[model samples]
Target: MKKLLSILTLSLFVFTSCNDVIDIEQPGTLLAENAFKTVEDLQLGVSGIYNRLDNTTQIRFNSVYTDELAIGDDSGGQNVTQYSLFLTPTSGMAATLWNGSYITLNQINKILVAAESIPVATGEQADYNNAIAELKAIRAYIHFMLTTYFTTDYTDDSALGVIALSTIPGLNEDLPRNTNGEVFAMIDADLTAAAAGLSNQSSRTFISRDFITALRARMAAYRGQYTAADGYAATLMANYSIANQTQFFNMWSDTDDTEIIFELERNVGDTYDRQATGGGGWAGSLFAFVNSTASGSPFMEMSRSLYNQLDAVAGDVRLARYIDPSSTISATPTTSTDDYLVTRKYPGHQSQPLMNDIKLFRTAEMLFIRAEAAADANNLGGAATYIKQLRDARFGAAQPLPTYASQQEAFAAILAERRLELAFEGHRWVDIKRLGARANVSIDRDPIDCTVFNACSLSNSDHRFTMPIPLGAIDVDAALVQNPGY
Candidate 1:
């Protein structure tokens, strides 16, 4: 997935030529059927799948749609209303999640098809199998993302989840929604197979057994499968240690590659058809105010509550690494009556100096997942121990360990820590959805943020918790149904 250093041109060409199974543009040079003829070709197809993920843009929106972001002064209201908790069925936001995810899934499916049929030499068998396992894991991941955003309730098996497409779509076929249970089962199976088959113990840029386990942990935690999540998360966390303060900042700077389980690598050579919203040179326009050609930046800012928490503990390393230290924001808009603090998370690369690598999974997330599951299982003290390791790294040894006195207290502390640690990385909404549902919690945004956007609070039972499928998807797929209260 090294867009700059590897066969990124081939990856991009494959992506554009085969984005949608139904509406694919004919490749002037290469054909989809012919694209994955050899094992090497199928491997390139996997890289192309990464290109689609790079441009999904869902991660940026995930922060915006929840309490993680505030409107910037230099903003358009393109998705501001959705962030205000007034979701629209026909909104472009819904389409972004739906369309972007499916397109990625379809690209993965193409790889799967090619991998299965491609003839391999005897020496390439193991490598080929591992590649196929990686594809399955990626396919599982895309489906998990869809169900997380589209399905109403994670625990409701009967709830309508996304279509479970295992093969390339035919023009005449119309797939129906599967139950949440069904979709999750597929994800679990894929990861299980992937973990058993994948042998790549190194390379954070590619899918490995660690990614499958980490994803399983997230999946289990979201679905309230505490025992299962705790087991999977424990295995991974035991293997990967959290980055220390110095190492942590370096990781964000793209200078160090410790603790990152899987990340999208965007080095200086990533100029051809780069997938971020910011277009080519930059990581996505997610954090830029006026960097190069991208414009999405200066549009969103860090939530005030998040800034306060990060700034609460003196000399916290996360403060500078996560937030723009210069405090440079183009505007902070009328409703959001605070200075715009851009996320320094995507500050920029060294050579390009404006783009940031899109980190997908990190070791710290595994620890948090383990802690969350332990708490869910009523092992509060165990949970505290698990969370404190990361907390100590962030807050330094001087800070006292806050006792997880009661289940509520443990829940509150753990979730609060998650909010801070995972800020702008896009875990805010799903964390609230599943955890809020479990605790019957409601979000009360800081009044300064709430009063401006008119979305100060979102209850556990709010219908906005579940989003509608994209209107465009429904228009074509007769078998698909909209989520309730959409």
Candidate 2:
């Protein structure tokens, strides 16, 4: 039997009193004071943090709100439209992302700070530190992601920043956001410490040295630190071989694989019961696919440009894995729509549904990073070799390696390939941000405003790129500044 990864659940303690009218207070339990005292306590705290992973699957109501997938066309509820607005960012999705990410950050910070204070009497000291390192790594990971969504560019290291919470919860203070440079410095420090503490461990399914290195390379590439990025990415690619086309899809089910550096696991008893169950609550419906409930509103559809780009490539196995035609559509405006293709990549069903794990870092991504870095460093031949490895895997035994006339062409091809291969995996927006090419594509608006989709032009100057700090958060601390334009 496969071991089920534990998900954390906690009880909230509240106090209420009746005054002249009535005053009620619901004070949240602190992980520092209440949890993380022993191995079991620490385990539960860690589980709580990892439970967020469920949000990435189709089972949770909030799963696909990010760039991963659009609200299916059939959804009419306010939540669906509110989520759709997030894709373009004129609506409140930006605030939600900012708030939700910070919430996770808070949990990580508490875990790290608390874990450090607990004295280890046995060999558990090392285990405690390892757990601390894991939490810290998760903190850095969340920050890296938050910065990508909230800031304009990784190169702008000097901008005024949001608070970098490294300690446990206390009195709210007005801490200035660190510069992008400062933020990356913190991320690197956390990851380096995590790597050192986590080394010599044999758990391949959890976050490991390779995972940290891959993320470091990803951050380096985003910062245009080409040589460092290439070096780290090269180490990863050379050690862990790329997954074959079939293995690429199959590895999602296996959980333990050379390709996945870290992932989130789901099972029967632990399964999300939203859409997977017949219930109509948040977890009850599959938002990525079109259904009778969604009407004609496909929340997210592939852009014509992306669709054509994939169609232009022959014998690419990835296109099939990433997209599937909707056989259930009917003919009226309500149905019979061929445009309603569903993403099968994240299908998590009861038996064989979406048991496929959520990939954190994989060997193929590292190879692409190395290719881009090598190209930027003017090592065209080296860049070409790496690019061919990835392309050939997708094209298989029949197709010949593509030829590029110039370094720029090879670079562009590599990027395009990343976009196609990594779509809906929470990567496209970051890639566009790092490249400073926000102006290149038009934004797709909600389906109700069909004209908005045609007219939504995006530019680097658009304020939408930087999300507004959450209203609730701002209300809590007057000193906390909102992102400019939000």
- Candidate that scores best on lDDT: 1
**lDDT scores for all predictions?**
0.70, 0.57
Those runs of model 2 whose alpha carbons end farther than 4 Å from true positions after fitting are: 1-31, 54-92, 199-204, 252-258, 271-286, 289-301, 325-338, 349-355, 398-400, 403-408, 436-452
Question: lDDT per residue, candidate 1, 1-486, as tens digits?
Answer: 111112222333445443343234555634456566676776666666665565325556667777777676567664467678777678776777776666666667766765667788988877888878888888899899889888988988888998886766665566789999899888888888888878786568888877877788888888878888888878876777788888888887788877887887776654433435523335435545554222434666677767777777787788877766456433333345446666667666654545677787888888888777777778888888877788788765646656776777777777788888877777777777777755555666667666856788888678777778877677777778888887
* Model 1, runs deviating above 4 Å: 1-32, 76-79, 271-284, 291-297, 328-340
For candidate 2, the per-residue lDDT at 83 reads: 45
TM-score of 2: 0.78
Cα deviation of 320, candidate 1, in Å: 2.2
Q: What is the C-alpha RMSD of each candidate to the true structure, in Å?
A: 5.7, 7.9
Q: What is the lDDT of candidate 2?
A: 0.57
Q: Could you give candidate 2's per-residue lDDT for residues 399-418 as a string of tens digits?
A: 55566666667666776777
